[model samples]
Target chain A: MSSALHTVSATDTLAGRVLHDTGVAVAECYQCGKCSAGCPLADEMDITPSQILRMLQLEMPELDDEVLRSHTIWLCLTCEMCYARCPKEIDLPKVMDSLRAESLRRKVAHPKARDIIAFHKSFLDSIRTCGRLYEILLIVAYKVRTRHLLQDLLMAPKLFVRGKLNPIPELIRGRSHMARIFQRAQRKDG
Target chain B: MTMKMGFYPGCSLKGSSREFNESLCAVMDKLGVELEEVPDWNCCGATAAHNLNHALSLSLPARILALAEGAGMQEIAVPCSACYSRLVMTRHELQENEALKAEIADIIEMDLALNAVPINVIQALDRALEGASLESLVVAPLAYKVACYYGCLMVRPPKVLRFDQPEDPMTMDRMMERVGAEPIDWAFKVECCGAGFSVSRTDLVAKLCKPIVTDAVKRGAEALIVACPMCQSNLDMRRCAIKGMSEAEAHIPVLYITQAIGLALGIDRKDLGLQRHLVKVALPRRAVVGA
Candidate 1:
């Protein structure tokens, strides 16, 4: 959700190495359907989490529209039950994350998925300046972006009055450390 | 010197789960553990973000880890189950491949020192619980039958997050014992709670929650203990929706980690962050910490 104002040209090859990065041996996934069977969101999908990973293994470039736009990506709760169940220990969520990122790049998003996206953008915006999320700013941005500006308005006033809504966000004392942290993480990997 | 792990509390604790953080700080300090919240950390992209964008998903948690390594803190403790899982997975991925680390570095413009530190909430809890006996530190033990709920986020999608054994994680149960509560052995430990649907799809949440709650009650748990805020909120707030589906009265209270700790520490009800809760506790008025 941190805006890639820092976009690069073919800079993120880590997407490939993420297979190794996750400690999940993707090669261990021998087309076994255990992941498909264990996935609560699998039956409702045309491309199961396992299939997506299989495509990754086979190096398939083009993904189906149903798989890209459906709430299945959003439906994955990241509980990691499937990873433990996988005889190969493939992290389905990691592969799903790659698929989700691809969907974002293609601008193929679910309807309600936009509202959630708004929250993501809002969240990063808060951290970019200060080092953490600002609850008030986040909710305000989420409501405004979704055009449901008044959904939690009443609750906001009550929470603010309770000293719970701190106006000043707890950002890094000096952002030099913050910027370096971002720069360093983008560089470190599997 | 004791170990000092970097902490990233995330937005929920800064807002709704503040009391949980407060109690965590208290109990940890009393136990001689020092937790330093990561300086200027961001959201771990939560459940919704990663689903929308995978690269960005790793990017979110990796960003926080990057800061901890900068501060010379090798390990990071994330309290929220979802954040812990994502951060841990991202850390694992970053460490396995040099190319990926270089790529993420290119995206965020920083070098991520991809060491294999555990980015887990329970792992952190396990470390925190070390050298301390659960039975010895109780002023107010939660003696009720408690169903330790994992609620999907803590365990799922084998590839990205392997926080526990997946099918049957016992971290929560162990913590419950330290708090003097009887933990229930149940099948739904790794089940889904229709996450994020509490706002988008209430019916789905109710449908998923009813069974989990019914099963917990049937197993004799007076309340549910959870590590994730979203799960706690959904399971607690959607009580009416879940209750409407059931034939019998649903009377179990859903509690967060710190709240349970607060009860065991005998903190007042108001201080325990109970007011914001949706499900009412069965305990008497005085026993509600920080009420």
Candidate 2:
């Protein structure tokens, strides 16, 4: 049985990349299910937090693809509940962050993650345009991208009446500085 | 002589949750604590940055801290817990990893000493209230029962934040007590309120926040007190969706810790931006004393 068993190297698997990117060792996860048990969104996830780690631990390419394409990565709110409760001190949120990035890079993100990704992109675009977040701009961009124009139409006028919705973007004098920061970060990551 | 401290309001304070910023400033002013807004501050990149590019996440917050440091500000009060988490985590990460620190410095085109420490609303209030009893400052004590909601970012990943007990934090509860508000020991005090998904996944947020609101109301909490702007928006703005998820109606008003303190200090409701809430701040008028 010992001779028939094959050992997979840590440096050559999805877990290795996760470890390299997030410094979270998936191999250290012992499938205790403690993370899944504590996760607030475990039931909603396509795969539980511990299962994501388990897939990485298995060192299988197909399992890795499934993990990346799973809605679990995008659905994660990154509340850090799993990490906070994990006995092994595994940083599951960091792992989720890395996995989401990888999923986006590989174009294997789940179809259900479109709205979530659209919102994130719109949020970043608003920041890149204005030095700070412009709520109206973010909402407009998100609505345009998702084409969910009528989703929150009622909330706008109410917010406007309450002075919660600012009509104009609050531009910072260091707008160019903000743009350069985004440019540099994208260049480095790209 | 008024004590001066740097303030980083982030985006929410400028827009959707302006009430939080107004109330926070009001409370601080009453305590003779003058807040100096950080000059030319930018966004902290929030959930979008970290979820997509790790480099950008560190760079955005590093730039904010570097700007604060250059302005000679030693400590900054970050009222938004999401921004607070990002700034504090960036400082911790950069301090531990020299290579990443240098990279972030290069990206932001600023020095990376990380001298400016980020303190959440609770910590800032604690500092402002030091050596003085909160009861002494309360002109009108709040007589209603409240559930002090800490929510995720304020006190989670306990290793990094190191603010209070992660699971059952009592800092906010104690502050509520000082203002004569009865804080009930309820579950979901530190639960996640579907943080950034308030916009993109409103349905999910409603599903997640329902239990929190339900528990608070079921436990006889007259209101839910929060320190994070995201939690306030999720619990307040998404009340309709939460209502749709259940047959029972839960209309408990979500109050920011600063707003609650401001009320206790007899600050004007309009000045505190109390009228901006989606669910009306209709805590029983009978609870107001000496008004």
Say which candidate scores most in DockQ.
2
Reference A-B contact fraction recovered by candidate 1: 0.41
lDDT of candidate 1 over B78-134, digit per residue (tens): 777667666776777677777776776666665688652545566776687677766
**Each prediction's DockQ?**
0.28, 0.81
Per-residue alpha-carbon lDDT of candidate 2 for residues B1-291, written as tens digits (9 for 90 to 100): 799989999999999999999999999999999999999899999999999999999999998999899999999999999999999989998998898889889898998788899999988998898888899988888988999999999888899999899989999999999898999999999888999999999988998899898888888889999989899999998898865443334568899999999999999999899999998898765555553
Steric clash pairs (candidate 2): none
lDDT score, candidate 1, position A4: 39
Q: What is the two-chain DockQ of model 2? A: 0.81
Model 2: lDDT of residue B263: 92
lDDT (tens digit, per residue) of candidate 2 on A1-190 = 5323323335457787787777777767778898888788889988888889889988898998999999999988989898888888989999899888888888999999999999999999998998899999899999999999999999899989999998989899998998898899989876
Each model's C-alpha lDDT? 0.66, 0.89
